[model samples]
Target: MNSLIRKMSMVITESLMSQRTICTNIRFPTFLQVSSPLLAEPMKKKKKMDPQIIKAREERKRKRIEKSIKKLEKNTKQLKPIEEIDWPISLQKQKLLRERTETISQPQQGQDILKAWRSYKYQQSLQETKMIDRISSSQLQALEQLRAISEDLYIKAIQMDDLLLPFTAAGPSSTPPIIGYDVLDGEYIDETPKWK
Candidate 1:
């Protein structure tokens, strides 16, 4: 009897499932149907290569890596030499000749003169600083006055001058130029040494 009941239950469940499937097919037709088949393929087998060839490839790769490492080491060990910093062989040979035989002592007024010079420099620096402060204060006062008088003019005055972008000035020469002097062009030769 128990076996008969189990068989009946299984049949009923199967019938219900079939009914559900039929109802779903009739009532809710699939809106999104896949046209393309699934991309399913067996995994490819790895190709067997010769051991000697593999070893040779690995050896070549290792040699290439070592060559690059050797190149880096060579570059790291070497530094570019500056020509100006190196002492000339001729100057090195004349070291003893260039040495002074007698030692000169400072004069008694040397310290006083140095102190006077330092004081003079300090005074000059103070005067320059004061002058700069005065000029800046005056400029600020002028800007304030302009701002109070006119807003547009003040705004224009505060903006950077584009005309001064390519500023160039010629300083006064030591001697006045001749009234009719013909300037001659001189050839320029570069004496700078090139280093690796």
Candidate 2:
């Protein structure tokens, strides 16, 4: 009887442990099915973006930019050049700014030749007079003083017998000379030609 009780107790403990290991709430694969046999069904389709579609989109964008650029170029071509239009003459002016800032007769180092040339102009002007000649003694003195500013300019202009014409008799003189303004612009009246 004692051996029978020990065997029955071991069997009960083993059954209780096995029951503890089991998950009782799980309804594992109660209605599992892969291929149905009750009725046939239509296949579902998947959509894909084709290469032709993507390439056509890119080509369309390129063409749009090209068209816009051509339009811009055409508009740019319509602009006018600087030489095309004849602007108002009043706006254009030629200023006499060369060596005007310096005194014309204050000689420095290598300026003796310039001094000689000025002296010669003084002598020449003294020897002659013209119809349009309105220069005073002071004016002649001032022009004589020009070598101080531009020795080369004064020397070159009066080298040949050329700088004395306008100050000489209006027409032909025994010697022709380069002439400058006695009256600046339109001061010459009944006898003299107006300055250009």
Among the numbered candidates, top lDDT falls to: 1
- Least accurate stretch of 10 residues (summed lDDT) in model 1? 26-35
TM-score of candidate 2 to 2 decimals: 0.17
lDDT of each: 0.86, 0.69
Count the clashes in each prediction: 0, 12
lDDT for 181 (candidate 2)? 32
Best by TM-score: 1
lDDT by residue (1-196, candidate 1, tens digit) is: 9999999989976866555532436455433333556889999999999999999999999999999999988899688789999999999999999999977757857987999999999999999999999999999999999999999999999999978788788997698879898798788789999999
- Give a tens-digit lDDT track for model 2, residues 1-196: 9999999979976875655544445554233223434776888776778989999999999999999999988899677657758555554443343326866664563488778899999888866764226556655666578867788877775676755564644665576554883644756557877788
Off by over 4 Å in 1: 1-105, 165-196
